[model samples]
Target chain A: MAGPSTYVPKSGFERWLDARLPVVRMMHGQFIEFPIPRNLNYMYTFGGILMIMLVSQIITGIVLVMHYTPHADMAFSSVEHIMRDVNYGWLLRYMHAVGASMFFIAVYLHIFRGLYYGSYKEPREVLWILGVVIFLLMMATAFMGYVLVWGQMSFWGATVITNFFSVFPIVGDTLVQWLWGGFAVDNPTLNRFFSLHYLLPFMIFGVVILHVWALHVTGQTNPTGVEVKQKSDTVPFTPYATVKDLFAMVLFLLLFSYFLFFLPNYLGHADNYIEADPLVTPTHIVPEWYFLPFYAILRAVPSALGGVLLMFGSIAVLFFLPWLDTSKVRSGAFRSIWFKAAFWLFAINAVWLGWLGSKPAEGWYVPAMQIGTIYYFAYFLIILPVLGLFETPKPLPNSITESVLKKNGGQIASGAGQPAGATSAPETKG
Target chain B: MAFFSSRSLKSLVIAAAVALVPAGSAFAAGDSKPPRMQDWSFAGVFGTYDRAQLQRGYQVFAENCSACHALSRIAFRNLMEPGGPEFSEAEVRAIAANYFVMDGPDSFGDMFEREARLSDRFPPPFPNQEAAVAAMGAYPPDFSLLAKARAPTRGFPGFVIDIFTQYQENGPDYIYSLLTGYDEEHVNPEGELGHYNPYFMAGEYIAMAPPLFDGMHVYQDGSPETIDQYARDVSAFMMWAAEPHLEQRKEMGFRVMAFLLIFGGLVYMTKRRVWSAVDH
Candidate 1:
C-alpha cells in the first residue's frame, strides 16, 4: 500500500502500524507527494467544489431521512412537520435541495474545462467515463429524491419520465409497470423511489473513489494541455493545489449559501409545493433545470421511440467522445480558430437547448429544438472528426516554463533564491 | 486542396443529413403574460418579513379564505413560530380551540371529534374534494402551500436574468395580481359560470369570486384596511406561510457569507504565501 514511500516510522506504535497497515504512508504518498501539473487553473478547482457539494448533499440528506416519512399519505405532511417542528430541519432540507443544483453547476464547469483542454484525450478516457457514470447516478438520485417530496411536479415528472421506457414495443408497458412496482405510480412507487434515492449516493461515492484512482494514475491535465515533461513542470499536491482548491471551495460555497438562504425557492417550480394530485395535472410539466437539455432533445423528435432514442443517444455519444474527437493538439488555445468557434457554438447550443426545453414543445420551439438537436449530434459525430483532420493549429510552446518566462520577459528568476511563503508568485503555476 | 479532395464529399454528406431533416411548425398556444413584479418585504439578500403585516394578513385569511380553502399543512404551533407572524402561544392556543378536529377512535372503536390542539393542522373546510366540488361547483384548493404553488412562467431571458437579479417574488406577485385583477368593466366573452379575473391563469374566468374587498378586515395595528392593502399584506403573509424559516434563513446566510468571505481571504493569502516559493 505504501508503494515504496520514503516515510519512516518515528515511534514504536507508528512502526508497528506502518508494517501492518501502511495506510498513513499511502495517504502521505497519494495526497501529499503526488505530482500535479502546475499549470492547472481555477477550473480545476471545480473537482474539489463538486466533492464538497456531494458530501454536503449526503450529510444533509441523511439528516432529512431521519425526520422524513416514506409513505405517500404521510410524506408531504411529514416534510411540513420537519420544516415546522424539527430543529434546523429547514436548513438541512434547503442545503440538500440546493446542493443538488450546485453539484450539477460545478460538474458542468468541470466537464466544459475537460472538453476545452482535451482532458479526456489519451490515458484519461477511463477517468472521464467514470465521471459520466457518476453524473448519470447523480441524475437518478436527484430524480428519485424529487419524487420523495410527493409534490404535484414530483408525481407528474415521475410519471412523464417513467413513461419514456414504455416507448419499447413489447417490454415497454411491462417495464414501466415493473419500474413503478404497480399498475400506476402510487405508494409502492414512492416507497421504492425513496429507497433508491437513499442508495444511489453511496454508489456515486464508490465510483468517485475509482474516478480519483484513475485521475491519480493519469496525473492532472493542465490548461496548457502539454504533458508534464520534467519535475519543474509539476508541483506537489499539498500546499499548492490544496490551497488553491480551498480558496475556490470557499468562493463556491458562498454562492451556494446565497441560493440556500436568500432565494431558496428561486430555482424551484411553484407547483412542487402542492401535494401530488393525480387527477389534477398542472398545465405545464417541467423537469428540474439541470435535466432541461436532454429533456429538450427528448421532445425534438416527432415519434416517441425516436425521441427516446435520441435522448439516450445524446449521452451515449459522450461515451464515444474520446474516439470522436481525434485532434493531435490537446488545448483549444492551440486549436484552429474554426475549432474553437465550433466548440463555443456547441456549448451555446447546449444552453439554448436547455432554455427551449423549458418552453412548451410547440410552435417555433419545435423547429428550434430540432435544429439544436441536429447540431448537438453533428458536433460530436461530424465536426470533431473532420475538424481534427483539416484544421491547422498554432505553434506549440517549448515548455510550460518557457511559456511563462516568455510572458514575463525572462528577467525574473524562477524561484532561484526566494524563500517560500513571502508573497504571491504571479503565474507560478503556468 | 488535398484536405478538400479527401473530406469534401464526407462533409457534404454530413451537411445534407443535417439539413434534410424535416422541420415542424407548431407554436405554443398561450397568451399568459409574465406576472408583474412587485416590491416585497422579503425581496433581497437582506430582506426580512414584516411581522405586523403578516399578523394582519393572517387575520384576513382566517376571517375570509379559511371558509373555503384549507391550510392543512400548517400546524397551529407554526403560527407562533419565529420568522412568521409570531403569534403568542396563548393566542395560537385560543385560535386552535376555536376549530374542531377529528380524533382517533376510542377504546370502543368509535371515531370522535374534539377541539383542535396546538399541534393540529388547520382543518379543511370540506371533508373531501368531492364535497368541496359539490359545494362550490369546483374543488377549492388548499391554502397550505398555495403561495408557493402558483407563479407565472418567466420564459427564457427573464429566467436567466432572474438568477443575477434575485427575482423570486413571482409567487407573491401573482397572488396580489389575482386578488386585485378582477375586471368589472369587461364581461367574460364566453359567459362562463366563474367570474372574470385577467390575472387568473385559466383565461379570464376564475372559479373563486373576488375574495378581497375594500375595508375587508380592520387591522388593529392602524394599517390601512383597503382592498389593495389587504391584497399585498396577505400575499406577504402567504409568502411567510410558504417559507416560515425565511427570516432565519437570511440571517444565517449573512453570517455564513461573512465567515466564508473572511475565510476566503485567508485561503487566498495562504495560497499566495505558499506559491511564493515558485517564480514565473
Candidate 2:
C-alpha cells in the first residue's frame, strides 16, 4: 500500500528487532521514501502545521484537566486559582484556549485549499470524508471545552445551542434533557461536558491516524492539480517536503505565539470572563468566531426547526462536496472565468454571513443575511454543478515537469528536464 | 454574446456593492459612540504594565471602589507575584491580616469568621445581592473579571487597523473612560441618583457614581493624585488583575519567536542542500 521499505539494519540487535516488529521499516517506507509532487506550494504545509497544533493542544489540555474542577460551583473559581497559584499554569491555559482558535484557522485554510485545487475529487473521497469527520469531532470537543469554563457565555451558550435539538419534534425535549443530564444546563451538564471534552480529543487523535493513513494511500494532491507521471515528477518526502514543512511550522508558531502572549483575548468574548448566571442572561450571546458562519445560517431562517435544519445542513453539504461540483478539471487555475467568479462570490458570501452573525438580528442585517445564505447554498447546489457542464477548462500540461518547466520560461534542458531552480546551482556540472 | 462576455464584470460590480452595504450602515446615526482610546502602558505586542502604576491603581481600588465592588478572584499574595504590583511579602501578609474571612467549625462544630489568610480570596463587602442592592440601591459588579468583561466594540476601519497594530487595550480603555466621563450639567434618570456616566455601555447612566476626585487619594510616593491620574492607575491595576502574567507572557513570546526564525532559516538551508540533486 506504501512504497517499498529500503531500511537496512546495521547492528545485530537492530536486525533482530527488525525481524520481529518491522515498525522501523514501516516508518521508513511511509515517511522517508514516500513520493510527493515536486510542484506542491506553501499551502501544502498546513497539514504538518495542523499536526503540531493538535499535539500542542493535547499536551497543554492534559495539564489543564489536572487543575480544572468540573463542578459548577467550583469550576470558575478553580480556573482562577490556576491562573493565580499554579506554577506556569497560566501559560498552559492560554495555549489551550488560543490553540483551539488557531486550529480552526488552519483547518479553514486547509479546507479552502482543498476546494481550490479539487483535492476531494476521485480516489481521494475517503481521505476528504475523514477530514470532515475530524472537523466535526473538533467542533464537538471545542464546544464542550468552552462549557467547562463555567462562565456566563459557557453556561448560556451550551443552553442555547443544545436547545436546538428541541426542534426535532417528538424526541427533541427528551434528547436535550438526556444530553444535559437534567432539565437545564446545570451541574450535571458541566460534569458531562468536562468528561466529553477530555474524551473527544483522544477520539480525534485516533481519527487523525486514519486520516493520515488515507492520505498516504492516495498520495498528496499538488497545486498544479497534475498527477506525477514518473520519477522526475516527484521528490522523496524527507529532505524536500520535510524541510519545507519544518519552515512553515516555524512560521505558524510565530503567529500562534503572537496571539498566546500579546493579544490572547482578542478572539474571546468579554462576557465569558463573568461567572455563569442562569437568572441574569448576558445582553449579547455569541459563540466563538469559528462558529459564526454556522450561527449566521441558523439565524437566517425565521422558523425554529428550519433554522436548526439549515445550520446542520450547511456542514452536511461539505460531506457531499466531492460529488457536488461535477467539473473534471482539478484546479481552479484552469476553470472558466465564470466558474472562478462564482467561486470567489461563494467565498465572499460566507465571510459576509460570518459578519452578519455577530450583528444583532434586526435592522438591515436580517435581509442581508438571508441573501447571503441564499448565495451560499446556490453556489454549491446550482452554480458549481451547472458551470462544470458548460465551462471550458484550459488545456492541461502533459505532465507536472512540463508545467514546472513552462512556468520557469522553459529555461531547463527539455529532454532530461532538469529543474531550473534546483538547489546549489553552482554545484551543477557544466 | 454581450450577456456572456460581461458576466464576470457584472458579478464583480455586485460583489463590490454588497461589500459596501456594511460600511455604509456603520456610519449611520443613532449608533452608540465608540469609546475613546487611551495611551495604556500595556497596549502593544511588547508593552508591559508599569508596576508602580499598578500599585497606585490598587491603592485607589482598595480605598474607594473596593467598598462596593468585590475583587473575589484576587488573593493578597497575587500583589507580590511577577508581572503585578510586586508588593513585599511582608506587605502582602499585612494586607491579608486586615480582612476577616469566614472559616469554620472547631470542636463545637460551628462556622466562625477568622482573619484572612494569604490564600483566601478577597472578601465581598456584602453577603448577597439583596443586601447589596438595599444598601446602595443597585448591584455593584465584581471587579475580579470586570476589566476583561467590559470593552467597546471597535467598528469598521478602526477594527481593521487594530489587527496590524496589535491594539488590545479595549477593556482598560473602556474602564478609564467610564471613570472620567461623568457630566454634571447633564443627568440621565435611568441610573441611580448621583450616578451619571455617558461612557457606560448600557445607557447614558450607570449605578455606580463617579468614585474618584482630584487629589482624593493621597500618593505618598510623590505621584500626582488627579482624577485622570487615578483613573489611569486604576485601569492599569485592573488590567494586571485580569492578566497577571502579562510581562512573562510577552517576554517568553519574544524568545520563542526569535528561536523559530533562526531554526526556520537553518531548515530552509538544509532543504536547499538536500534538494541540490533533484531534476524536475
Candidate 3:
C-alpha cells in the first residue's frame, strides 16, 4: 500500500534528524499523512479509545501498585488504606478497576466490528491474528490484576480458575500446583500474580505496536469492503480520523466517568470488599463479566476435560477465521442474507452464552449453555465454511469512492475547496 | 443513505428482535426473597448523605453495636472531615478520648495503653479472631467494610438494570433487611446460640442475637427513635464507612460528565469541519 512520502521537513533540524534516524519521517508516513478509508463508521474509533484506555490504565495501575501491598494477609487492608488514607486514592483505584471493564468493552466492540465487516479476511489475516494475541494477553493481565485485590472473590476466583488446569491428564495436578506457588492460593500466588500482572500489559503494548504496524501495511477495509483504488477514495488520518476518534473517545469517557464517580463499585463484586478467607467460599464463584462467555463454554459439557477443550477451542477457532469463511467478499455489506442472519445470530448467541455463564451450572442453564456452546462452534466450524461457497453476494461497487458516490444520490457532495496541506495526492499504490 | 441500506434494515430488524428477547432464564436461587429496594437519600447521581442522619447513626453505633462490632477503619478525626458527619474538632477530640488504644513502646520499653488520639483507629473488642470467636462463639465482623462486604447477589435483569439505575445500596439494603428481619416468627432458630434469618447471605441462620429493639436509643435531634430508624441510620453510617468519599466522588463525577459533554460538542463541530473538504 505504500506509495510516496507526503511529509517534508520545513526545518533544518528535522532534516538532520530524519537523515540520522528517520523516526519522524517514519511516523509522518505511517500516521500523520497516512490515508484511511473515508467511510469508516464510529466502530473504528474503538482502536483509538483502546489506546487511550491502555495509557490511562498503565498510569493508574502504576499509581495503585505504589500504595498496594502484595502480601495476602495485608492486601485487603492495604487497599482500604489506599481508599481512605492516600490522596485521591479512590479516584486512582476506580479508574484502574473501571478502566479494565472499559478496555474490555472497547475490545469487544472492536472485535465485533471486525466480525461484522469481514475485516479479518484475506491480507488482513495477520492483523486479525495479532488482535487475537492481544486479546489473550489482555485476559491473562486482567485475571492476574483481579487476583491482586486479595478478597473473597479474588481468592476464590483464583482458586476456581487455576483449578481449571487440574483437568489435564497426567500433568494436571502438577500444573495447577506450579501455577500456585504453594499448595493453595496464598502469599506466593499473590506475589507472583502481581509481578506478572505488571509485566503483561507492557507485553500487550509491545504486541499492539506490531498490530498497528500490520494494520498500516494492509491498509483499512471500509464498510463496503472495497479496497482503496485512488487518493479520492480515502482521506488523511490527521484531522479527519483524529477529530472523529477524539469525539468518540470523549463520549466513551462520559460512560467511563459515570461508573468512575457514581457507580464505581458496580462492575466490581461485593465479595471483593471482604478480605480473603481460604476456610470458607462464597456460595457463588463467578468471574468478571468479560470472562463470562468463556466461563459458560468451560461449563457447558458434563465432563471436565470436555469443557476445558471446548473453552480453548473457542479461542483457537478465531485464529483460523481468515481461512474458515472461504468467502472472497470482505464485507458483510455485500454478503447475502445467510451471512447476515448467521452473523447476528452468532453475536446474540455469544451474549446469551455470557448470561448463561453467570448462572450456576445446574438445571435448565446447563442445557441452555450446551445449546449456546454448540451454536458457537457451529458458526465457525460449519456455517462459515459452507455458506461462504454457497451464498451469493450483492454486486460490489467498482471502488470505495464509487460506493460513496452511489450512496449520496450518485453525486459527490458540495465543497471543492483547496486541499489541506499535505493531505492531497496520497497516491495509494492499490 | 449507506447505513440505512438493505443490509442495515436487515440488521435493525435482527437487532430489535435480539433486544426484545430477554437475557436467558433468570437465576433466582432457592426460595430466598429479594430485599425491598430502599429509596436511600444517597441512591442516585445527585444523592448526598444526610448530615443529621449520619450523626444519629454514629450515636446508634456507639450506644449499642460498638460492644461487639468494631469500626476499625474510621478515626475520630474522620468524623470532623467535610462530606461526613462534620462534627466539631472539640466533639471529635472528646470522642477520641473516649477509647483507649494500644500505643507504641515507650521509653521504658513497654507497650502502654492510653486515650486514643484523633489519628488512632477505634479499638476492637477482641484482640484477635480466635479470642473473638471464643468469646462470642462466632466471629464478630469488623464494621470497616461490612456494608460493602455484605452486598447480596442481584441475579440477571435486575443486575443488568442496576447499572442504569445506579442501584449500589444492596449492602445497606441487606443490612437493614437483616436487622428488621428478626421481627417475624420464622426468623428465630430452634436453639439458643443461633437465630434464623432468611436474609443472611451465607446461611439461613445467624450467630448474633437480636441487637436492635423498638426504642434502641433516643436521638438528640428528635428523629424517629424506632428500630427501623436505627437500622436505617446505622446502615447509612456503615455505607459511609465502606465508602467515605461517595459525596466527593459523585460531585466530581458530575463535573467530569459535564466537561466531557461540552468537549464532545466542540470536537464534533471540528470533525464536521475537517470532513467537509473531502467529498465522496
Candidate 4:
C-alpha cells in the first residue's frame, strides 16, 4: 500500500484536480502520516465498536419502522403483527430490541475507558466531553423509543416519567401539559415521541462523527504510560488496530446472538403482553433494566426535586471528570492503594443502587437506596478528588519507549534515536 | 513541578464547581397529587371472543349463525386450527371440495384444504376484500385488529369507576358481564335495542348472531365438550395468536437484562484492566 518515491504522479483526473485544490495533499499528509501510540490495548477498540453499533441500530430501526404503525389504535397490534405474521419478523424484532441494549453496553465501555486512562485530560478533553454529550442524547433517544410500543409498560412508563415534570413547582403543570400535548399521555404524545425518536438517532450520528474527529486529532493513549515520540513508538491505525477491533466486534456478536435466539423475551416485561389499559393498572410498574440505576437514584431522595437533581447529578458528574481528578499522574496503575480500593467500592455501590431501583419502594428499600445513592455521589465528589491529591504514584518511566523496553527486558534499536542500552542518554523529549 | 501542581489545582476547582452546583438544590420535589392508579381495559382479555374462540365460536357460528349470518373474513385455514372457524385439512377438503376457487388460466380452481403452511397468506372467504366489505357493510372488521379495536368499546363506565375504588380482580369485569349477560326477560325494547344476546357488548342485541355452539369440535384432548370451555380455549388461543411474541417478549426482557448484567460486569472488568496502570 506504500507508494514509492518522495513524489508520485497523479492519475489523469487527479492531475487536473491537483491544480485546483492544493490543500488536498496537506489534508492527506496530516492524516496519512499521523502518529498513534503503539501500546494501545483492546480498550481503545470501543469507540470503533460504538460506531458499528450506531449503524446497526439505525439499519434495524428503519426496517422495524417499515412494519410499525405509529397510530395509537394500530401501534400495539402492528407490533404484534410483525412478531407473528411477518417473515423473519421474529429475528428482526429481536435484533432491534437487543441491539438497543448492546448499544448502551458499548457506549458505557467507551466512556469508562476514557475515565480509566484519563483520555479526557488536556487537549483531549473536548473529545471526552463530546462523548458525554452523545451519551446523554443516547439516553434520551432510548427513553422515547421505549414508549413507542404502547404496551402496558410503555404506556405506564411514559406516564410515570412524563409525570416527573409535574414536580417542577409552579410551571410544572404547564410543562406536563406541553409534554403530553393534552391533559394525559395519549395519541399525540405517542406521535410526537415517534417523530422525535426517528429524528434523534441521526443527530447522535452527527455528534459521533465529531467525537471521532476530536479523538483522531488527539490520537490515542497507550498502556505504556508514555506519549508517542519517534516513528518507532507508533504504528498505522489500519491493518493492526482495525483487525483487532474487528475480532472484538465478532466476539461481541457471538454473545449478542446467544440472547437473540435462545432467550428473546428475557429482557421484556410480562404486563406488556396484556394490552395497555388506562383504566386498569398493573400491580407493579418499573422501567426496563438499563434505566434502573438512575431510577433508583430518582427514588432515593425524599423530595421530588431532590430525587430529580440527584438522578441528573449522577450523570452530570461524569462530564466534570476531566477536571475532578487532582493527581498529576494519568493512569490508575500508578495510583495509591486507597484510590484503587475506593474505585472498586464505588462500582459496587452503583450496582447496589441499580438493584435498589428495581425493587418496589418500601420500608427498607428507601433507606437502602438512600445509602447507595450517597455512595454513588461520593465516588465522584469525595473519593475521586481526595484520592487524586493524596495518592502517591509509582515512579513513571522517562518515556513510552523506556517503559516498554524495561518491561520487555530488551532494547531494540529505535530509529532517529540512540542505540539500545544507551540508558544514560537523556530521555527523548516531546 | 509548579506548573503541574497549578494544573492539578485547576482541575480540582473545576470538578468541585460542577459537583456542587446541584447539591444546594437537592430537595426532591414532592408529588402534590396522590399516586393515581391508571385504569386499563380488561375487556380484551376477559369478555371478547378471540378469532380462535370465534373460530370455535365460528363452528358455533357456522352450525348456529352460518344459516343466517356469515363471517366472510374467516378462511379454511382458520377452521383447521383451534383459533378460527374453518375445519381441519381433511374436514376443509371434505367440506369445501363442493365449492370452487378461481384457478389459473383455466378459471376453475380446486377447493381449499384444512392445513396451513408458513408460505400461505390467510385465504379470504370472499373473492376480494371489496366484495367482503360490500357483503358485511363494515366487513366484520378483520379479526386481526378486532381484539384491540373492540376491547375499548366493551369497557363500560361502571368498570372504570369501580377499578380504583375497589381494586378487586385484575382482568376486565365488564367482559365477564358481557360474556354471560344474556337474559330474555331484561330485553325491553328501549333497554335492549337488538337481538339481546346479552353476550353482545351493547346489552344483548347485536347485528351478528350468537356464534357459539355448546359442543362444536370434539376435544382432541378428550376434555369436556362444553360451549363455555370452547369459548375459554378459543379466547386463550386467539390471545396467543394475536401476541405470539408476548411470552418471547417478556422472556427476552429478562434475558436482555441478564445480558446487561453480564455486559455490565465485562465493562467493569474491562475498566479495571484499562485503568489498572493509571494513578488517580
- Candidate 4 on A138-203: residue-level lDDT in tens? 988988888888888888788777766666779877887799887667789999999999999999
What TM-score does prediction 1 earn?
0.92
Candidate 2 chain A: worst-modelled 10 consecutive residues by lDDT: A421-430
Question: Which has the higher lDDT value, candidate number 1 or candidate number 3?
Answer: 3
Return whichever of 3 and 4 wins on DockQ. 3
Which 10-residue span in candidate 3 chain A carries the lowest summed lDDT? A413-422
* Maximum-lDDT candidate: 3
Per-model TM-score on C-alpha atoms? 0.92, 0.92, 0.93, 0.64
What is candidate 4's TM-score against the reference? 0.64
Say which prediction, candidate 2 or candidate 3, comes out ahead on TM-score.
3
What tens digits encode model 2's per-residue C-alpha lDDT throughout A111-188? 888988889988899999999999999999999999988898897788778877866879876887798786667899
Better of 2 and 4 by lDDT: 2
Q: What lDDT would each prediction earn against the true structure?
A: 0.81, 0.81, 0.84, 0.60
Residue range with the least summed lDDT across 10 consecutive positions in model 4 chain A: A421-430
Model 4 error, position B20 (Å): 26
| CAPRI accuracy category, model 1 | acceptable
**Candidate 2 lDDT by residue in tens digits, B1-280:** 1232222432332222222223333322224456678898777767888888988999999999989988888888888877889999998888898899887787799889999887788999999878899999888988877888887777666766876888888888888888888887874546356556657776655677778899899997889879999999998999888888888888888888888889888987887776555643
lDDT of 1 by residue, B120-220 (tens): 88999999989999999997787766777887777667877888888888889988988888888766666567787767775667789889888778789
Q: In candidate 2, which residue ranges exceed 4 Å CA deviation?
A: A1-3, A410-430, B1-32, B188-194, B276-280
